[model samples]
Target: MAQDEVEVLVVGAGQAGLAMSEHLGARGVPHLVLERDRIAERWRTGRWDSLVTNGPAWHDRFPGLEFADVDPDGFASREQVADYFAAYAEKIDAPIRCGVDVQRVQKNVGRPGFRVETSDGTIDARYVVAATGPFQKPAIPPVVPGNAKVVQLHSSSYGNPEQLPEGAVLVVGAGSSGVQIADELQRSGRQVYLSVGPHDRPPRRYRGRDFCWWLGVLNKWDEAAPPRGAEHVTIAVTGARGGHTVDFRALAADGITLVGMTSWFEDGRLHFASDLPVNIANGDATYLRMLDEADDYVARNGLDLPEEPEARVFGPDPECVVDPLRELDLATAGVTSIVWATGFVSDYGWLQVDAFDADGKPRHTRGVSSEPGIYFLGLPWQSRRGSSFIWGVWHDAAYVAEHIAIQRSYLAYDRAIRSSGPHLTADTSRHNQDDEPTVTTTGGSAVQVERAAGAQLGER
Candidate 1:
């Protein structure tokens, strides 16, 4: 087995990992980025063909990099997003090793670093940055009967309407992906059934501005993560049809059947809970809440912004609210395809450390893990509502880089004073023999760490 060593190892070459690599490079940090496939592989292979970005081009991009030839309000396609990241990787000259599958990562035995096992070889890293992004494994629930005869596909594998067989398509899960796929299928002349779920309703544009801009100025993007075990909300907005707010009433009127949460599948019949009305109500509540926040923000500053009264229709749809479908006979309805757009889950089985909570949530202060020498980046709500967004990832990577730099500087200083361990290249001018070392985080700002005085090498 080949053995290598590095100061830092970043796992995943998606937006998150590339951002980490770029920041580390800018700091002159000795690091290497490992990816199981090519850069931005998930965007190229894991997403549907017809999918577009959730945010518009201007707001959903890395800082200082514009999506050229794309309208600022327009949404980039899946291909465009993948290419954009690839181009960013190139522009930053990121040091990446692709096609390397990381098998496991554990503390180095009797050492001060981690042993990262990969298909290529073992790479000993002083610190490991798990920048795999939010999506790891497709979370598809088992709702199909054992004997059902339907072409089932998770949203990760779903391509376009033409790929499915000639029959009705039932899209379960009303998150952005599911809703967008259902809308696409229905517009392609296929009978579509959308299983609505509890989701946050966000308009594509609100008050002559993109919804992201409103969220940014309103500080919604800076919203902190909820307490552990608290329920979270999934955004149900879409960027399809250039960019538009999702109106369930309009979708119902457009001939797509709106169903409730799927309960069970038995006797070739799919049963649904009567929570359709409640879900619609909850979504409407969020919609109204967003509008009210925006309106108040505008009024508070006396800022001039147009009000689209047409966007404020809060009435429930008759088909979905009054007479929601409870049960559907798959055979009778001629439904042949099922697209499960359920959410994704992180697979940390390869990570052998105590950096996670009982619920498998990463235990981190921002991106800095409780366990030293370990960090996480690009997790949804890891630090804020925008942690997983492209620009958010860049900022998060910078924070993590600062943490790593400060830690490395302290270690180097201690080693130079004590004359122990291998030589490190980290600058240690901040850790002279004068002040005590301590670290604290000021939310949404640059990292703040006290100078080190007598801290030993390898002290976290």
Candidate 2:
């Protein structure tokens, strides 16, 4: 088959890739987006029915598109948000190849392009954008034994309480998904137990202002100016990440018993840290204090107030108690369901590229990866204030797109030099940082095979 060529190739058609494709198309850059499934397929399939965006609708939009007729304080349901993304792709007429699973992507070492092999065909492009979301993989805890009869499902697989067997349910992980799922299960009349961890629990609203409003007012979302490595940096947690703040107090008010962090699971029962509530409460206090300081800083900085700052507290019941190292035996406790709302992991094994660091994260400055003509968007904390959020990817996308354009211009200069004659030597330094062979691949055979394949393609 003849090789398909494009100026840019995007490896995912989700929010980030779609946004990049939209921007690239608007700029008249030739690009093609490849998605393994239909656009927004994860959101449509992976989320539970009760799933609603934790952040408000206004904060959930991508660039050049807005969630229409939605209340700023109201969260968009999973279906609604998915539809919005579908509409976004339609609006832009993005050149997306849906259902095309990319098997591998490797640099054309001897050439100025990349070789992308997919289920449909092979694509060679001048640039590749890894817009596959950060949460492409779910992180399942290892504490649960494989032999247990208890039904284990990640928050991504949970759709509703009805999916659980008859009996009480123990929802593990005190993050937003765990708490929210626990609340949903309890409201469905299932006796629910939440394994609380060190987490922040702010109200959905503060002083009649949306929590998001305050987040913006205090620059909590302004991750750009934050002290590097600060854990308090706000992340955009819409869609699968759920909202940053879950109504834990409200869940407790509805009679869901909060327990300590899960230590381990044996015989289908979950063990918890006896002092779980204390840890949760302490973390809650720290968050409140941070918010208070943020409020004060905003006021001191002469920032206009959205509303009068109100005294806010964290956690549901200040007096809630938890036993240290207590075991909640699911068989004895009659809890039949275990929902792991733990978190996500980024698994990029499919992108057979040598640009990642030891931690498996793509080595990049801004969105520019160590590999030339390769970029990443929608990374956690990629930019200031919710840069990984659907809305936030726009800034990174625009910046990266502009950078790509500049690199394209430089490539033109290099091409002109090459076309002029053998008198000019290639300035190898112009290649990006990945050109430096810092570390060899873990699999020498795989690297050699890739190099051999690249060599064969170059010979073509």
Best candidate, lDDT-wise? 1
Please give, for residues 1-460, the per-residue lDDT of candidate 1 as tens digits.
Answer: 3999999999999999998998888777889999999999999989888788989998889985799767988999888998998889989998899999999999987889999999999999999999997789887788895458898888999988989999999999888988899999999999999999888888888889888998899988898975343355567889988888888888888878999999899889999999988888888888888888999999999988987887876655675568888999998999999999888888888889989999898999988999899999999877788886888888889989988877776665455556744443332446555534343211112223343454432243
Per-prediction TM-score: 0.90, 0.82
Residues 1-460 of candidate 2 have per-residue lDDT tens digits of 2469988999888888988987777666788999999898878998888788777887668756678856765688888888988999999998888889888888897888899888988889899999987778888889987678677889999998878899988887776677667777887899888877766555455445556666676666776644544354222123333344454555676778777878876666677777666655665665576567656766787766564344453443523453333787778878777888877888888777778999998898877899887888888778776775677787778888876765554444345455764322333444453342111111111111123323211121
Number of clashing residue pairs in every model?
A: 0, 9
Give the range where candidate 2 is weakest over 10 consecutive residues by summed lDDT.
439-448
The models' CA-based lDDT, in order, is: 0.84, 0.71
Question: Highest TM-score: which candidate?
Answer: 1
